[model samples]
Target chain A: MRAIVLAEGAPYAPAPLSASHPLPPPSPDTTLVTIHAAALNHRDVWIRKGLYPKIVPGSVLGSDCAGTDESGRRVLINPSVNWASDPRAPENPDIYGMLGLLPLPGTLAEQVRVPSRLVHPVPSHLDFVHAAALPLAGLTAYRAVVTRGEVKPGDKVLITGIGGGVAIFALQFARALGATVIVTSSDDSKIARAVKLGAAAGINYKNLDWRKAIGAHGPFDVVIDGAGGEGVAVYIKSMRPGGNLVVYGSTAGSEVPLQIPIVFLKNINIKGSTMGNEAEFKSMLELVSKHEIVPIVSSIVDGLERAEGAFDMMKNGNQFGKLVIRVHEKHHL
Target chain B: MRAIVLAEGAPYAPAPLSASHPLPPPSPDTTLVTIHAAALNHRDVWIRKGLYPKIVPGSVLGSDCAGTDESGRRVLINPSVNWASDPRAPENPDIYGMLGLLPLPGTLAEQVRVPSRLVHPVPSHLDFVHAAALPLAGLTAYRAVVTRGEVKPGDKVLITGIGGGVAIFALQFARALGATVIVTSSDDSKIARAVKLGAAAGINYKNLDWRKAIGAHGPFDVVIDGAGGEGVAVYIKSMRPGGNLVVYGSTAGSEVPLQIPIVFLKNINIKGSTMGNEAEFKSMLELVSKHEIVPIVSSIVDGLERAEGAFDMMKNGNQFGKLVIRVHEKHHL
Candidate 1:
């Protein structure tokens, strides 16, 4: 099988590809997926650059993909594996499960093995590339807005960094829930795109004080922050008393200085969410299927051989929505 | 009517006292409580020393008191008063209501008027001083642990600075809920007292790294933090994944420089809780009554004349529990 294997930690300019690798047979309760399309994540760039120390030298680096299994059913790979079994699962001892992070290999290859439970049947109406984009970023946004933020129909929601994958999803999700969505973006084009996507307002953070702009919105009930650092403090100040601030990523920076007195005085709640649980994933898929909400496919590269180009486009932030690598020929089962 | 009034804000050594002021008349549906005992809280000291800028000259400064109303019912005053007609009243506002920092007349005087709803029936077994101590500190602790923290039995709870009023109540409340209480204090005497009051473990923060010390017992399911400043970073690090860190006050100063990465990775929750609502107040009182939990009264000062002494003792941190002022003779009513 042809796979995009990380030979050594190097820049994207040095093409590193393994055309032939032995593919392992699927173990019991595991299905072997023939990758139809795999999406590029920022994590893929990080893993390939050796930014994450935990990644082994030869590890495949992708978490979102849509493919066909041994049974020839099209599905989206739920990349998040928990080695620790769900405490709620009746048959299992409390054992940890794994998603894409550890001992299990990632999705950026010709073929991958996953537990039957982690693969969900993709709706027949959805294409493989679009289905591949829904697992990681979609679930993350679902958990941030729906599960953690508890976004209500009339609630006012603020999505920071309008152009990012999760932010875009949050904007759509909040609007779909009947919330008034406000977005902040440094780029005017991105801000315009977000506005076109049903955002009530957009602030070009480069030109205006987003804090004052958000203040003019008069205190949002929920603030979903993808841009961390000092931006979080500004967003926190922009929240109404007893409002919630859900943080999933700190793309700007990690260390943020906070005013503890103000936080207590306002009685705010700060929650940190990562990815969604399996139940949340199913619910998100259901919402997408029911609403016919299509994931914006920025670009699709042909073949697993072009995976590096997809990674580069994502790393450069030139692509909007998600970028995918079509691993199999369209007519091939 | 006799009242403890600060003619001017100053240190307790030259404390001002005035007694010739007229008692406030009770308005519609209000109660005139003949103050039997008024507790000296840290707020009183802050108000007296002019640390609180809103406290005007001749302002009465006390938050907790228990006495007999005009109807002869034994009652405890809820100092957080808000006008019943205020738009925010639908939320069942507090006595002082949402304006927590404003200098409202306190409960230290021989005669005080409170809205009918702010006065709660006292348990017959509890004396005036004990009941007076339960309003501010007791309510704050209760909200931090039970209402916001949602502490459960068998959960490990951490209380910082156990000698203070809120910490003492938190220690008792967590213990009453069957949680394993771990307290941190700089004083050995306070540590000993906390253990006797039901703390499973006490760490002298002065002698050891509190985080390391707590790590031995951790990871704490709930951490009630009043000690702010950089110590909050340590406290946040001490919490278990998915645990809650409830902050009510920042005694050590409010600036908390934090690492946002740690928050997202650990999936922790940080909530700010103020003094509880009327429902929470009633619930706490019921718990206290059911458990026959008498507030630990450190000392009692006789007469309004000795109110200055009580204030000084509280300011100097010399009291183990609540420092209360007995405003009138036992038979005066």
Candidate 2:
């Protein structure tokens, strides 16, 4: 077994992973997955740079992967584990974390072991690469758009950071649910690409008055945002009374300054969402299957040895969709 | 008819309300009520000082009232009106506001008129002064604790700014619903008084480490807060995973700096609640009736001519519950 390990040092200038790491053993009630494809996420980049919390050395670093089980069934791995039965939160949240984070073995290796229940059959419409792209980002977007944000038919939905994996999935999911989708991105080309993917409109958020640009088309019913920072105030102003703003991640700083009076007076609801539960994971896959939606694979590098190339592309933040590593050939299993 | 008008001036500098202003007229589908008693909220203080939006010079300054309607029925007015049919928000949120704010005539007059639908029959257990104290604060608290906050039996609930009308009502509501209630106040005597009123514990927020005092007992299921400022960060830290922090007012300051990552990672929800809708007002009354809860009235001015006394007390923030203006004799109806 060969794996990519988070070598010591900052996230940038990392050539930490090695190809000859020893194979990890599978425990009872856990199945060994021969990973055919693995996807790189911003989380991976953050962990490698030591910017994220609880970074452990020698831990295989990936949260999204697809492969085959002992039963020879194609499966996608849900990286979120140890969730509480309560749909609202994870069990032992202080210690709760996703795969590739500290303590958990990620799917960056030739073979990885995970709890049996965390495995779901890949949607028939997807291959190993697309399935690998769907779990972490797809489930997060599903919870933000459908479960918490409560987007409905004809609802006006806005997804920020349009080129990111979660934002892309949220756009597609909202469209599938009959919502009129709008997107925002820093890059005009990425915005254009999102519009081509069926968004009703797109805005380059780099503009000083980006919110006003979106406001021209909004008073939106649902806003799926991952950037939690000073810019959240502008989004708040754009919301209609009683609108829902669902925040899934904070890539931009975490301390957000809010206008408290406007929030209550306008009857706006700000919901903070995260990785989502097992049930949501299942629902996300079902939606992908029913819609026959093919996830966008922005760039692909063949062989487990080339995983760093995918990481580099993700770090650049220019990719429009998932960056994948073909760990093993699809027929190898 | 006689009423108090918001004269142009700084809110705390002078006696802005004059008692000899002309009376207001009732609208269509509305009924005139000879007000027996009226209550003052912090909103009145803000409007008087011109700190709130949409301040009109001649508008009557009150929202909570108990009086006699046509046919001599004893009733209390529900200040929230023209709520949108959507369960999530008000119909015309921009214009929809409580009584006595601008646009709507408040209940601080000798005679007041309101939409007939906003009137609820006073519970048999209450008199004019207590009934008048219950509507604005009661409805806001009920919406925060039961409807939006989703407090359940045996839940540990935290109510901040316990001396205020809405916070007091929230304490009573959560306690009545079988929740273990804790309260915070800057005044030690007010905290002692809240504990006497059935709060399980109390902390004087004046202490620099007040959150540390409460944290020993918390990981609270629900926290009902009125002060929104730097202290909000401490409250966020005190919450357990999946906890709900319901904010109804921002008397401390409107610009609240929040720790964004903690909110999402803990799966905590920060909900902005205000005066409830028509349905929730009705539900609040039903709960009041079911529990036979007697609203606490902290001070009572003798006549509508002395309404300024109630306003002054609210500005001082010394009262532990509602401050009322006895507008007319109870038997005058």
Candidate 3:
């Protein structure tokens, strides 16, 4: 099978996935998927650069995929495993990990095998490219906004770092749920784009007084923070008493300094969340389908051979949404 | 009415409350109570040094109390108002203020008047001193341990700085709910006393590596922290994935530095809570009655005249449990 493999020294290579079927499913309860499209995430860039943990040379490298199964069902795979029964956390976290690492075949290949339970029908509104874009970022945003934030109709939501795929999804999902969405981005154009995409307001956090500026618009019900509280004091200050701040990721360094007294005084809740469970993955897809929310595909490169181009675009960090690799032409199983 | 009023410059005076009908209940639905006992909180200490917000000089200055109401019902005041109908927060935070300041008379008095809704039946097991200790600290702990932490039976729980009133109540409440409670205090004597009081284990956080030392006992399901996360990284490191870290106050300085990545990667939650709402206060009382959990009272000063001594002891922070002022000899109403 053709796939993008992590090669020795030179990094990502288009190679034949061999060595006695290392990519094959370990169980009979699993099905093979002919991947039509796969998306690039920061994990792929990190693995390629030897920045990620437990990297295996010659393993196919991609976590998000849209494909056709043996039953010819249009599907997208849940990127995680070993957490089907537990909604709060994986039942056994020691064995829990996302796909694309060793012991789990990546979706960058022509075909990949996975547990049948990890496969779900793709939202009816999306194609292989957009569906491939949805799983990892969409599920993460869903957990932060709906599951953790408890965003209701008329709730005020603030999503930070607007251009990233996850933040964009948070904005769209919060809006879909009838929330008044606000976004923060250092780039004015990104903020403008977000405002155009139905956000009630946008703030370029580059300004020294952006935090103070933000307070005028809020007393927000929920703030979706991708970075930890580098601006935590400001975030909590803008929150209503008893408001919730759901943090999904942290780009900030080791110690995120926060004004802890405000949290004590204001009755604020700070929850840390990440990749969601299987049930949340299903709910995310349902929400996408019901609201006709399309995954924002910032850039797409054709052919499995051109997967690195998508990776380069993602690494450059200017893309507003997902970077996808259209792997197969027709993918007729 | 004889009450402990905040005297100009001198501080915490047991002066006779003069001014025409100032201590009388403003509404027809309110009741007047003859206070048998009153308790001191850190807020009382902060207000004494002129450090707390919205200080109303000459106002009676205490929050926790147990007394006999006009109907001969033995009761304790809820300490807060405008939040009776709102479970999550005060309906109008602008009007939301606890007793012990102007508009709401302090509990350190011969008699206090309040809305009927703010008064609750005292636990059958507790006398005036213990019941007086229960309201503020007990309500705060109940929110941190049960309402926010969602601590379940058999859960391993961590309660930090266990010598203080709120932390001690958290220790007892978590234990009463069938959780394995562990405590941390700088004083070895305090830790020993907490273990004797029913904690499963104790660690003296005075040790330089107490944070790492704590890991051997847990993988805690819930951690009740009175101080904000000075040891947040260590706390989250010892938390089970999807565990909750509830922060109720910050004894540490203004800024709390936390390892943000661990929170994001571990699926940990850090919530900020203070005094609970009316429903939570009722629930705390019910739990106390059902379990016969007595609020630990360390020192009892007799009569409103000696109220300043209770304030001084709380400020010094040498006590292991609540410092209570026994306001009156048994009152027949």
Candidate 4:
């Protein structure tokens, strides 16, 4: 089986393509998936740079994928694995792992074995490439916006770092829920592009008083942000009283000064969300199917050999949406 | 009406007691209560020290009060006023006001006029002093523990600053909900008292590795905290996955280094909760009545003439519970 294997070297070492990786056999509770398309995420970049610990050399490296099973049914793999049975939270959150994150083999390989329950049929309207983009980022956005943020009809929603896959998905999900979506980005061009994608408004965070600049668009009912930094305090103030700030990442570095009085006095909720439970994953797919929401795929590479280019693009932070790898032809069986 | 008023001086200047203040007149929508007892809060102390802005001169400076109404019914007043209609949050949080803070007259006077809705019948089990202690601190604890934290049976709860009024109430409330309560305080004697009040365990946060000291008692399902400081980052790591850390104050200073990855990765929720809504207040009173919970009042001054002494006790951080001013005899009608 062909796979994108992490090279054996120091952090930031380039991973190379290999066609001689051994194929994983299906366990009794697991089924074989022939991946047609897979997508790159910040996780992959971080892993390549050795920022994420316990790097397993020669391990397959993609968390999001869309492919076919023995029954030739279109399915997208749920990357978040080993979640506890509880609906409210994972039973052992500390030990929870994702596919392609060390112990679990990712979807970059042409064939992978996974628990049968983790596979869900792709929306009929989406092709494998777009379907591949929806697993990790989509579920994350689903939990942040729809479940945690509780974006409702007529509610104003703000999503920070507008060009990232999760932020883009959050915008789409909030808009699909009939919310007025607003976005913020350092790049005005990306903000403009996001506005074209049904965002009600956009703000360039480069301005000293971006919060005041976007005052007319707020106070937002929900804010989906991944950046947890000193600036987050400003976002808290921008929210309506009792608004939800659903955070999933900290690209801007951790350690934010939180004005405690403002949070409690305003009845604001700062919910820390991540890759959701299986139920939320199903709901995300259902919403996608109902709305025919195609993930924003900014670039597509031809094969595993070009996977490094996708990773480099993500490292550069220039891509506006998901960067996908065409593992096989759509007609492959 | 006798009351305590902030004197014209620098921050931390002593406020003076006055017996010649005019009594508050009851409006059609308001009721006049003859105060039998009123408790001093950290808020009262802070305001008297000029830490709070816009301190109104000649204003009575107490928030928690228990007294008799025109009908001679025993009552306690909830000082949070003019909340938004929404049950989840206040309408305009920035402008939300509390009695005795500024602009609003407090309960330090012999008589106070408040909207009828803010008054609730005191449980028969409570004396006026104990009842007064329950209104402000009790409501804050109820909101933090029962409402925001969502503590459940068998859940392990952590309340920081165990000796404070809010912390003590949270300990009691969590225990009432069948939770295993743990506390953190600088004073070991306070920890001993908390354990006597049904706390499962206690940790002295003054120790550098307090997290390790309480490792066996955690990862807590809910952590009701009022102190937000550098130590909060460590507490975040101590929470179980999907645990709630309900924060109400920032006595340890407002800025804290929040490790964002730990928050999202653990799926921990840091909720900011303050005085609860009217519905939550009613529920709190019902719970108090059901459990026959008596607020812990550490000291009782003979009359409003010694109200400044109560404030001084709080400012000195020596009181373990509430400091009450006995305005009149408990049997006053």
For this target, which candidate reaches the highest DockQ against the unseen true structure?
A: 3
| Candidate that scores best on lDDT | 4
| TM-score of candidate 3 to 2 decimals | 0.95
Worst 10 residues of 4 chain A by lDDT: A84-93
Tens-digit lDDT track of model 3 for A267-320: 788887788888889888888999999888898888876766677788889989
Q: What TM-score does chain B get in every candidate?
A: 0.90, 0.92, 0.93, 0.95
| Cα lDDT, all candidates | 0.77, 0.84, 0.84, 0.84
User: What is the alpha-carbon lDDT of model 3 when measured against the actual structure?
Assistant: 0.84
Q: Which clashing pairs does model 3 show?
A: none
Alpha-carbon runs more than 4 Å astray in model 3: A10-26, A252-254, A329-333, B10-26, B85-87, B329-333
- TM-score: model 4, chain A: 0.95
Q: Tell me which of candidates 1 and 2 scores higher on DockQ.
A: 2
TM per candidate comes to 0.92, 0.93, 0.95, 0.94
lDDT of 1 by residue, A49-116 (tens): 66775666666667888888888899887765652322112122133333444467677777888887
- Give DockQ: model 3: 0.73
Interface RMSD of 3: 1.6
* DockQ, computed on Cα atoms, for candidate 2: 0.70
Q: Pick the candidate with the highest TM-score.
A: 3
Tell me candidate 3's TM-score on chain B.
Answer: 0.93
What's the fnat for candidate 2, on a 0 to 1 scale? Answer: 0.68
Q: Write model 4 residue lDDT over B6-57, tens digit each, in one string.
A: 6666766664777677777556888888898998888887776676767866
